[model samples]
Target: MSGFVVMGITAFAASAYVTLDMSQARPEVHGPAHYGLLVAHIFTGTVAVVAGVSQFWPGLRSRHPRVHRVMGRVYFAAVLPSALLGIVCAQLSFYGLATSGPLTVLSVLWFASAAQGLRTARRRRFGAHRIWMIRGFALTSAAVTGRLWGLLLGGLLPDADGLLVFTTANWLSFVVNLLVAEWWIQSRGYTRALPSEALKPSISSRSAQSSASVA
Candidate 1:
């Protein structure tokens, strides 16, 4: 987990380094609005990546539950704008529909995962929340994996069609990440908690409140 955190943060740093350069903004592609969207996407996506990883840290979650909750909210908030902007950016990409198609799908799924994660968490379905959040972060990690895929594909098939490479990379990015997430969830026993187990936290909190009221 620690290693994963380091890798996530490193990926964010690399993304920022590469994308945050104003000089690299291709206004000619889709004009100034696209540039703004890219900036917003990268910044909010960074927030999601960082907060998402923090939510998974055992020490942080155990010792600092309040902090965990706060960061979870942060992650949720960041994911919305980031994913929405990603979709817009994809549609407007000069790369045309071939490359944009998979990316648009990825952004939509990313948004849905974040929404589902928050819904489960709100219902006090902690185990389901964990699973959904894992899925959410898996999609978020596509920002990293997508780049890696592009690099690998580019290197392996230097003469490959650019459109094919971009499309393949975009699809593999979230597909592979989600597959790994599913495997980890099952192996780690993160399936939905039993009904009783799911209710324990809420019941305990209510009992504490009752005791305080009586006293």
Candidate 2:
């Protein structure tokens, strides 16, 4: 479980590094508005990678639910803003996919999954909340896999065909990533650190208690 989490985060960090640096170096990669999207994407992506890495340090969060909550809040803060920017950039992407299409569709879906997961967990819907979080995490992994496909396609195809192939490959990567992660969850036994309902109170209580003791 921990390994998977690290792998997922590393992937995102690497992918974002690739995309962000490319966006900076080559004006051709993005349009005027794309520059703004790039900034948001890079900034939020860096936050997520740091937060995700912190999750693995057992003493950092495993022993301290308050710390976990703080980190989770940062993660959500990063994601929500980046997601909105992604919706705009998705419309401007090479595929001509509308903001209402799969590209933007994924952005909305990602936000919804995260929001619903948090909401249900608040309501003590443990299983459903877990499912939604896993789904959201899966969606996030697309950031990584999309870069992998682009790299792979770049090597295989000529420059003229490479960009087209990469775009198509990115679409396939997300579909495949979601399918594989879902399959693993259904067929293989994997569980997160805390149950969703238990997650909220545990963190909030810890935070309150810590603050009270300090006062």
How high is the CA lDDT of each candidate model?
0.84, 0.64
RMSD of 1: 6.0
Give the worst 10-residue stretch by lDDT in candidate 2: 23-32
Candidate 2 deviant stretches above 4 angstroms: 1-33, 52-61, 98-102, 158-160, 188-215
- What is the C-alpha lDDT profile of model 1 across 1-215, one tens digit per residue? 65475466546554643645666653334656667788788778888888888987889999999999999999999999999998888888776888778889999999999999999999988888889999999998887788789889999999999879878998999999999999999888777333665555787799999999999
Q: What are the candidates' C-alpha RMSDs?
A: 6.0, 9.4
lDDT of 2 at 36: 62
lDDT per residue (tens digit) for residues 40-77 in model 2: 66567556545644544668755897897687677677
TM-score of each: 0.81, 0.66
Best by lDDT: 1
Cα-based lDDT at residue 87, candidate 1: 89
Clashes of 1: 0
In candidate 2, which residue pairs clash?
Answer: none
Q: Model 1: which residue pairs collide?
A: none
